[model samples]
Target: MKESVSHIQGVGPRAVEQLEVMGISTVEQLLEHFPFRYEDYAIRPIMEVQHDERVTVRGKVHSEPTLRYYGKNKARLTVRVLVDGLLVQAIFFNQGYLKNQIHLGDVITINGKFDRNRLMISGGTMKTSNQEVTGGLEPVYSVKGSIKITTLRKYIRQAFEQFGDQIGEILPHQLLSAYRLLNRRETLEQLHFPTDTVQLKQAKRRMIYEELLFFQLKMQMFRKLERQGEKGQQKRFNKEDLLVFMDKLPFELTGAQKQALKEILSDLTADHRMNRLLQGDVGSGKTIVAGIALYVNAKAGFQGALMVPTEILAEQHKASLKELLEPFGLRVELLSGSAKAKERREILGALKEGSVDVLIGTHALIQDGVDFHHLGLVITDEQHRFGVEQRRILRNKGLRPDVLFMTATPIPRTLAISVFGDMDVSIINEMPKGRKPVDTRWAKHDMLPRVIEFLKRELGKGHQAYVICPLIEESDKLDVQNAIDVHHQLTQVFPEFTVGLMHGRLSSDEKDCVMNEFAKNNVHILVSTTVVEVGVNVPNATVMVIYDAERFGLAQLHQLRGRVGRGQAQSYCILLADPKSDVGKERMQIMTDTNDGFELSERDLELRGPGEFFGSRQSGLPNFKVADIVEDFRVLEVARQDAAKLVNSEAFWKSNDYEKLRKKLEEQGVFQDQKLD
Candidate 1:
């Protein structure tokens, strides 16, 4: 199965190069490259076929085949055939040589599109009727660079003939009997050239199950290796001291926040290293809970590191955390890429000398020169923004540190289980007390005047507002509003108030300055793109006006709506959009209907599918060849349970019953290390 493509019969140097272009270098890879679709060439009676329908009919040639030369390098062959006592003309394009092979009275099977009125079949392939028809389902490979479909099919057949026996079964016998799945070799054969629809379905089930089971097994192994031999720090902190720290806050802790903190505390005090994910909607007070955990770690005489995606968020966290923990003599410092050289040097020195209790930074925290004194706790904000390798680098800085991942994007439970199956999840669903859900409304473009009046009413109450646009600059392709144009229009509408414009094109320092002014209430109205969707916290903002709301996804609209409604005042989110498609209108209606991020995420997944849910890059979803995380969720659940049971069983790992599965996983580099991407 590992043999090169060149080893296959009829595959020479040119064929191997063409196969490699499609990412098929080995025989196993070639076999795994399943067809995207299939074509059925079953024989049908001419009277039963509809006009312009592709059909296959067996006919006897009645007229001699004639070849004609048309424009440059073009030729056509026409032959008359009798099917069901009705004469029909069969036309083949660019196959002039077929005239020599086809003759009068030759019984041939013609498969092509039939024109009933003209009694003609164009672009048809003819084969002798006496030859067996491999016609139930014909696999169609996505070809490129001079590779014909017939050539590809023939090469695949040759590959199976030469090395079919090497494709051994990877699933255990019990699983095979339990699931009623076909053996691996038979599964591949049926997938490539299925005899019937029933076999095709069964073969597909086997493949999907195998892919999902292996993936879940890899996740289970990763979880096992995370705590197999490592000993984590058992932090000791006084309960009275922790309660006193919480009581000093101006606002009381919500029940959900307390629960999440309790879970973190359990992981922190356990002997094994903790890998936990803290998920909550926007404005759920997740930061305060994380702050409490950091405080406990500091009291235990170990340093803590908090990493965010942007410098503005790091600064905001440093300010808030310092205010919360500094009174107890626990120091908090900020480190970012834009920090001055002297300040960076001093902070690094302090971090190494055990002076800084909590260090908050951006990607700069994972750089080479940054070292910690006794790092025991690590927290990454917006965990999806960093890749798996980046998180691993930070964790390697400490000896089995208890890691906590925080995200404002509330993932659905199904996706959470599939992607973060190895980590313990803590969700804070309850919003803090006194916080009211934002009043959502949808309006068309003609309602701009009324929307302006509403915005003026909110601003009249001395509250800030945010006007979001979809694009930063004008685009010739898109008909939506841009930030620059929207900024100009809003500045004219609200001449008395200060309107600040910000976008991705702005420098980091410029963005920070704009955000700082907005936070200080110096900027009355901020016009920006989606750059503010993540971590800009302004409590006094009361109204959010999004132009071209239909252009954004439901999850994104929800995030922008979260930018406001942070303060004690009643907040409103006005969606100014006139969607043309039903899906777009449904999205607008869904936004106005509920404020639950989890529900919105599920709907978004259903509307856009798993690939576009969180986007392919930041989604952290494994790219399975056969299984879909959304459609095959039930199969995934079953596979996850089975893999967990097998990993926990002592006999499965030690006995010969599972040696093939173990060796296959090792060959795929699953057991070589604990790294997961």
Candidate 2:
């Protein structure tokens, strides 16, 4: 089964190259390349076929075939045929050679669209009585670049014939019997050439269960490896000191914040290293909760590190955290890439000598030459921005330190479990007291004057505004407003106020400069793209006007809306859109209805589907061949529970019942560096 695809009969060198292009270099890979859809080519009677319906009909050729040449090497072949004693015309495109083979009174079958009114079948394939049609649920693969469907089908058939007996079952016999599922051999056979609908459904169910079970088992094993025998620092901090620190804060901690802090503190005191994800909506006071955790870590006489995605966010956090923790005699330092050479050297020295209790920076914290004397806690803000490898490198910088990943994007509970199953999760759902929900409204493009008037009134009160556009420049395809155009128009409309432009095309320093101007209130209105969606905090910006709001996903729209409502003044979010589709209209309506990020995320998942919900890049979801995280969530839950149970059973690991699973996991390298003990 591991043999190269060239070993298969009729697969020449050129065919091997094409199969390799599709990532099928081995017999096993070729077998696993399942078809995306199937075509039903069951023969049907012409009298029973409806108008403009796809039907496969058998007929006898009554008229001679005529070939006509059209523009640019295109040809049309038309022939009259008699089906069910009714005369009908069958048309084929670019198959001029069929004219020489098809003849009068030849029994033929065609599969294509049947026009009942004209008694015509266009875009049809014809087969004579001597040729085989192999009709009934024909598999259709996603082919690319000269790989014909018939050629792929032939190759797959030959592969099954040669390697069918070599296939082995990965799932245990007990599971197959308990689930009443077919064995691996039968599942593959039925998936490729299913005999009936029932068999196809059963085959798909088995594959989905197997894929999800393997994924969940991997996650469970990772959790075990991180926690088993991994000793974490038992911080010896005084409770009175923490209480005194909390009391000094200007605002009281929300209930949700307190709950999250309690969880973190419990993890810090435990003997096992902590790997947790702290998630919340924007302005939900998650930063404060993280600040408290950092302080506790500092009080334990250990160093702490906070890594963010951008220099602007790092700078913002440095200021706020210093104001919060500096008074308590915990030194907080900033180490960004743009820091001067001498300043960077000083910060590095302080970090290594234990002078910097809490160091905050961008990705520079993970680079070389930055060593820690007693790094106890590692926290990453906008956790999704950093990849898995980056986080692992930072974790290796210390001795099994406690890690807390913070993200302002509120993920739905279902997605959170599937993506972050290896770690504990804590959520902060409450906003700080005295923070009002931003008033949301939806308007049409014709209502721009009213929105501008509202913006003028808000700016008159010394408040700032943000105008978000979908595109940076004019697009030949999309007719929506662009940032540059909007900036110029707004500048002319408000001559007394300053308008700034910022987009992805700008340099990092330029972006920081623009953001700084906005933060200082020098730029009254900042017209930009979604570059400001993450962690650029400007409290004075109370108004958010999103142009072409329907072009964005619900989660993104929610994040953009969160930019405002940070200040004491009442903030407003205005959506300018005239959606033509029902889903787009529903999206605008949903945004105006609720301000809860979690609720919006759930709806967003439903509206955009799981693939587009978080985008595969940021979702961290496994790419399953057969399992859909959303449609097969029930199966996923069952698989997760079973995986947890199996990993916890010590006797099972030592028993014969585990040999097959152990072998399979070993083949997947799941237990490479893992200790079963």
Candidate 3:
């Protein structure tokens, strides 16, 4: 097996350049690079065009097309086509590039919605790629900036002509037989050019399974590496010390919180390092459990560190941890980029002098100058916010610190295991006692006054409010309703009260200033972008009114609402929804009917799909071809189990059986060369 191939067969340097634009490089990568969707462009007679069903109509241009410009940036090209005496107005919008592709009186088959008056096929989303597109079924690859589907089709067709035979089968014969999977060669050919929808679906499944298996194999291998050779001290939690602290809490811990705490305590007391992930819904008492863990590590004469994604969150952690642990005389210090010259001096001196028992801060804690006396444990908040390299930096701060990561967004258990197998997971699903489910409602633009009246009512009770918006400025299409505009309007309406605004455009310092004003209760309302998603805990804020709520993901809305309801007071979330989208209505409905973030997330996964869930940059999930995280979960599990089996073998690396798998992992940058002196 080769580590990497220079160029895919039959693809020229120019074609290779195009593939690289979409993040494809070598033959292995190209083979693994599956299509985003399979367009079943099977031919249907011109007379068999259904009202809603898509159809391809063969026609010849009756006249020269004319590019017509509509007002305010709306432009389209229109032409009449004659197919079997049925005249269909073929309209194309924002497709000025397509003008060059077509010639006057040219015969063509246009795949679009066939209507009596007009055919509305999106030339932008769909196009006629060469390689015949094989009317039975064909693969459609996604392209990046300037890389068209037509170019991708050409390169793929070239790939098939050249190296189609080089595609190797990685799955074992027994496993393939057990799963009743298609043969490797047949699956590839069918995926590139399928006979029917049934075969296309099967080919897709085979390919998705392979991609998932490769990912699972890599994760399982890393998990093995983490658990096998690492050793952790076994120190039981001091029950008397813990009970003394718990009894002093202003509010009692919930049953779920207690259970989660017990699991963390057990993990910490074990001989192996506590590599665990703590997940709970937003507003659940995940922080308190973390504080308890830090206290335990502190009592055992070892230091603890809690790292956060932002400085505001760090400040919140510092204040809360101080209040909870100050009675025990635990020396807690806050370190961040904004620390005063004298304050940072004191923190660094105390840290190096072995006086600081616990430390909380942002990425600044991972820097070289911040030394610990005896670092025993490390806790991370909003675990996914930090990247892999940043996590490694913090881990290298101490001598293999017991790492624990916490996430406020609840993920499905299968997803949890699949994504984070290196870490033991403990979930706190149930809410704490006496916590009220936020009263959620979906409103429209017409109900603005009603929502404002509700906000004013909350304010009359001396409660703060948060008005959320997705964008910072107004566009011609979307009414701005920006936080800036809202803030001005709000301040003018309620002149007696203070109003503060924040958005992504503001610097961290500016945001922090606005957030501080809101936290201090100086601002009656905080009009802002989604920047308030995971900041300080403001218990006084009881109302979250999100304008254009449909633009936000379900998990994000939950996070925004989490900004409120931190206190014992009842909270309300008013969502302004657009009537144009039914999917948006369903998304907002999931939030209004229930308070389960996990439930909302699964529904979100089903609705918006995985690409929107994981975000585009984080894992490039939306870019995957056939691997539907939701639909292909069975394949994910099977691949995970197979990966576990392979990693267990002492000679798995030596086996010729895994040569293709090994080469694939290497190609994925998972296998670094082991150089020996």
How many clashing residue pairs appear in each of the predictions shown? Answer: 0, 0, 0
Candidate 1 residue lDDT tens string, 1-677: 99899999899999999998888999999898888766667887899999999888888999999999998899999999999999999999999988878878888988889999999999867788667677687887888888889888899999999999999988999999998999999999998989887998899899999998988888888888767866789898899998888778999888989899889999998888888999999999899999999999999989999999988889889989999999999999999898899999999999999999999999899999899999999999988889888888998898778999999998887677766777888988888888899999999999999999998988889999999999998998899999999899889999999999999999988998999999999999999998889988898999999999999989889999999888789999999999999999999999999998988888888887645665654544667766776778789889888999998999679988899999988987877754564
Candidate with the larger TM-score of 1 and 2: 2
Reference-based TM-score of each model: 0.87, 0.89, 0.89
Model 2 TM-score, all chains together: 0.89
* Candidate 1 worst ten-residue window by lDDT: 610-619
Which pairs in model 3 have colliding backbones? none
| Decreasing lDDT order of the candidates | 1, 2, 3
Name model 1 segments beyond 4 Å from true: 40-135, 143-146
lDDT of 2 at 460: 98
Q: In model 1, what are the clashing residue pairs, if there are any?
A: none
CA lDDT, every prediction?
Answer: 0.89, 0.89, 0.77
- The true-structure Cα RMSD of candidate 1 reads 5.7
Q: Which stretches of candidate 2 lie over 4 Å from their true place?
A: 43-132, 673-677
> RMSD in Å for candidate 2, one decimal?
4.1
Error of 1 at 474 (Å): 2.6
Candidate 1 residue 182 C-alpha distance from true site, Å = 1.4
Report clash pairs, candidate 2.
Answer: none
Residue 45 displacement (Å), model 3: 2.9
- Give the alpha carbon lDDT tens digit for every residue of 1-677 in model 3: 12233444556667667667777776656665666666556656666676656676666777777887778687787767777777666777876666666666776667665554344443422343442546665567767877777666666666666777776787767668877899787787787667898887788778888778777777666666655566776665568987788788888888888888888888778777777889999878899899988999988888888999888889999999998888899999999899899999989999987899899998888888999888889898887788767777787677767889898887887877665655678888888778888889999889998887887788999999999987787766876477778888999888878988889989988988888888999998999998888757888999999998988888888888888887889999999987468888888888888888888778877887644566642442324567866667767777878888887876568877677777767766655421100
Model 2 has how many clashing residue pairs?
A: 0
Answer with 1 or 3, whichever has the higher TM-score: 3
